[model samples]
Target: MFVECCGCKYYHDMPSNIYEAMANPEAVIRPRGNVGFTGALSMTVKCPWCSHEMSTKCCAGYAAMVYVKERLH
Candidate 1:
């Protein structure tokens, strides 16, 4: 997945382990230094290139969730 930086307009590629981390929080690296994400439907992540904060809901993760919900129901 790619995260676009609002500051620099850079698209940062997300780690491949992100899906595993979403399913199991303990399985991924914390890029933003102990940002708490417990019980949250979405998260705030920093743009790797520009250090600009962005919402995870804008990413494909939420779309994937919607797709899964549609497929399941």
Candidate 2:
């Protein structure tokens, strides 16, 4: 599938087993990162077309969780 974020586009190959997961209408965790003193950060996005899952970061913490929940559902 293809995703557009912040004016950038990302493409992901749907794993045979996870293809259905992409249609769950919920956001799924994608990637994680650290923000040193802030602890961790994360980014999350909803597939605008399918309402699937996508995320990134590690230190963003609750912000990430909130983003996931808000964007997915």
Candidate 3:
């Protein structure tokens, strides 16, 4: 599974255990950040194609596609 860059919409691979991390109640990726290009957390991610940074807390899966799509507007 992977997340898309908010800048170029390029799909970047997520950490193999990201879903697992999300399940941890103690995990705190924060609601926003800009550090997912190389070392991605459960929150932020950067664009590999354009280098644009954006938050990924709410758009981490297909279930959130509606919310993520709404954000594009």
Q: Which candidate is the best by lDDT?
A: 1
Q: Please report, in order, the local distance difference test score of every candidate based on alpha carbons.
A: 0.50, 0.36, 0.49
Q: Estimate, for each residue in 11-51, the C-alpha lDDT of model 3 and write its tens digit.
A: 65555445445335245444334545544345334455785
Off by over 4 Å in 3: 16-44, 57-60, 63-73
TM-score of 3: 0.35
Q: Model 2: which ten-residue window has the lowest total lDDT? A: 57-66
| Candidate 1: segments with Cα more than 4 A from true spot | 16-43, 57-73
Per-prediction RMSD in angstroms?
11.9, 16.0, 12.1
What lDDT does model 2 reach? 0.36
TM-score quality measure for candidate 2:
0.24
Query: Model 3's lDDT to the true fold?
Result: 0.49
Residue-by-residue lDDT tens digits, candidate 1, 1-73: 5555556767656665554453344343545545666433444366666665554444344322213445544
Return the number of clashes found in candidate 2.
13
lDDT of 2 by residue, 1-73 (tens): 3223322343444443233333342534333344345432233345454554444321111211113445544
